[model samples]
Target: MLVDIGTEEGNSWLGHIYNLQGFVQFRLGSTEDALSFFNKAAEAFRQMRRADDGPWLVVNYGNLAWLHHHLGDQAESEAYLSKVDALMKKYPSPSQDELHAETYAEKAWTLMKFSNDRELLADYFQRAIKMQPEMVEWNTSYFLWLVNTSEHRDDGLAANILEKMRVAQEQDPENFCLAACYLEQRGKKREDVKDEARELAVKVLRNPVSSYNGMRAILRVYSNYISIDEAIALAEEALELHPDERYLKRCAALCLKRKIRYFRDRHTNQSMIDRAVSLHEEVISLYPHFSLVKNIDLANIHAKSNNGMAKADQMYQDLLKMDLKPAEKQLLYNQYEKYLNSD
Candidate 1:
C-alpha cells in the first residue's frame, strides 16, 4: 500500500514485505527462495538511510543469521548477528517489562545460535529473565543450556541455575520448562545423589511429552535406579505412544537385559527366560547395531539358560557371519574365544 500510494519511503515498505516473505519461505523450507528474498531485503534496508528504523531490519538480520548458520557460513552468521546486536544496543530495551523481556530474549536466542560462548549465553538469558522473571521459558532455556555445557566447567554454575529453576517452578507451577531444567540439573548431579535423581526422573517420566530433554533425563534416571519391571513398563508405554522412538527402543532393550540378569538367579522360572529372549529378538529387529556391540555378550544373551554351548556357539557364529566391520569382527572373535577358553 505504501508503494502504491507513492508515500515517502515506500521502497522501505517493499523491503519489509520481502523480509517477512523471506521468513515465511524459510519456515516453509524454501531455503533458496528465502535467501534470495533475504538478500534483497537486506540490500534494500541498507539503501534506506532509515534502515535502523525499518520494520524488517532486525528480523532480516536474524533470518540471515540463521540461513548463513545452516549453510555453514559461521563467520557470515556472526557478522549478521553483530549488526543486529549493535543496532539493538543503540536502541536499547524498552522500559516496559514485557517488551524489555522480549528484546532480551531475542538477543539471547541470537547469542545461543551465533556463538559457542557458554558464559555469554548464560549472561544473556539471565539478564532476560531478570528483565521479566515471569518468563519461565527463558529461565528454562538458560538452565538447560547450562546443563549441556556443564561438563565443560564446574563453577557451581549448574547448581546455581538449578536453584534458580527451582524457584521459577515455585513461582510458576505447571511450568514444564522449569520442570525440565530441574530434572536435567538433578540428572547431571546423579553421582552424589542417585536416589534423589532417580525419584526426580520418575516424576519427569510421568510427563515426558513436555520436552525431549526431559524424556531423556527420565530414561537416564531409570537406567540407574528403577527396577527392571518398572523400567520395562515405562518403556512399553513410551513405545506404545511413539513406536518409532529409537532412544526409547534402546532403553527397552537395556531394560530387558537387566530383567534377564535379575531373573538369572531365579532361572527356575522359564517365563523370565522366554520373555528375555523375546525382548532381545525385538531389539535385534529394531536396533540391529545395538545387537552387534560384542559377540560374547550377544552369545551369552542368546544362549543363556535353555540348552548349552551349542545354542550360544550357533548364535555367535551367526553374528560372525554377518557383514561385521573389522573392529566388530575382532571384538566378537575375542569375546567368543575368551568364553571358549574360560570353560
Candidate 2:
C-alpha cells in the first residue's frame, strides 16, 4: 500500500511512510527489511530536517530499541534506549509528566493507518494539541478524523462534528478539501451551497496539480448538490488534466455510475452508459484486489442497457468462480439476487 503512495520526493510524510513500512515489515517477521526501513526512516528525517536528530527521532529510536530487544540483542537495545534517554532529557515534555507533542502526534498519525482504536488515538491527538496547540496541521488532522468517523447523518453531520468542521475550516482556510466537505454538510442541511461550491471549484482548479485529495471532496459536493452533468464535466476536466491518475479515474467512474444508475430520474444516454462501463472496466483492472464492488457496479449498469445482459451474466459467473470469503460471497449473492430480480 505504501509503495503506491506516489513517487513525489521530499514529501513531508516520507519519514512517516518509511517508519510505518518498517513497522509492517517487523510485524511480518522480516527483521532485516524492518531494520533497513527503520534506518531509511532515520535518514529521511535527517535529510528533511537538515539535522542529525530531534524529538521526531524519539519514536524511531523507540522502534529500534524494541526491534533489537525482540532480536535478543541486549547491547544494541540498550544503545537505542540511551539515545532515547538523551533525546528526552534534551527536549523535555511541556507538562514534564506527559509525552513530547511530537511523539504523541506521530503516534496518533501512525496508529490512524494501523489501528481502529479511535478512542485511544483521539486522546493522543488531544494530548498533542494540549501540549502544542499552535500546530495547525495537528488540529486539522484531528478534526478531519472526527469528521470521517462520525455517525452518518442523512442531512448533515452531528452538531458536535459540524462545529469541529467549522472550526477546522477556519483554521485551515486554504484547505479546499475541508472546505468542500463543509459545503457538503451544509448542503445536506438545505443551505445554499452552490455558490460556495462553485467558488471552491475555482480555487481547487487554480491550484497546482498534485496528489492531494481535495479535488475528490469538491467533486462530492457537486455530485450531491449541484447538477450531475456539471459534476461529470468537472470530473472529466480533472481526468483530462491528469490522465494517468488512477485515483481521479476512480472518482470519475463513480461520478458516471451515479449519473447512470441512481439519477435515473434524469435522462442518461447510451454514450454515458458506455463511458461508465469503460471507466469501470479499467478501474477494475487497475485495482484488481479491490474490484469486487466495481465488478458488481459494472454488471448492474451494463444489465440496464440494451443487449448488455450477456456480459453482465458472464461477469457474475466469473465472480461466482472466484474464491471469495464467506462474507464476500454473502454480499455478492445479495447483490446478485437483486440484479436477477430486476426488470
Scored by TM-score, the top model is 2
Model 2's TM-score against the true structure: 0.84
TM-score, every prediction: 0.46, 0.84
Q: Give per-residue CA lDDT, model 2, range 1-343, as digits (tens).
A: 4654432555555677788998899999999999998998899889877899999899999999999999999999999999999999998887767889989999898877778999899999999988888767678777667656752667668777788779878987876667877888888788889999998998877654544446777888898788888898998998888788787788889898988877865378788889999999999988887789999999999987779999999999999898999989998999999989887
Stretches off by above 4 angstroms in model 2 are 1-14, 25-52, 64-81, 94-97, 206-212
Per-residue lDDT over 1-343 for candidate 1, one digit per residue giving the tens place of the 0 to 100 score: 1111111232323355566567668788898988998887777667764544532367678889998998789999999899888767665665544334545565565565447977767777777788677656566566656665653443335466567767766765554434544554555565444565455555545543423325544554455444456556767777677676555655666666666654455533556556556656665666555668633454675555667568778887787788878897898888778767753
- Local distance difference test scores for all models: 0.60, 0.83
Candidate 1 lDDT score relative to the true structure: 0.60
Q: Which ten residues in a row have the lowest lDDT in candidate 2?
A: 3-12
Which stretches in model 1 have alpha-carbon errors above 4 Å? 1-61, 64-91, 94-116, 149-162, 177-213, 250-343
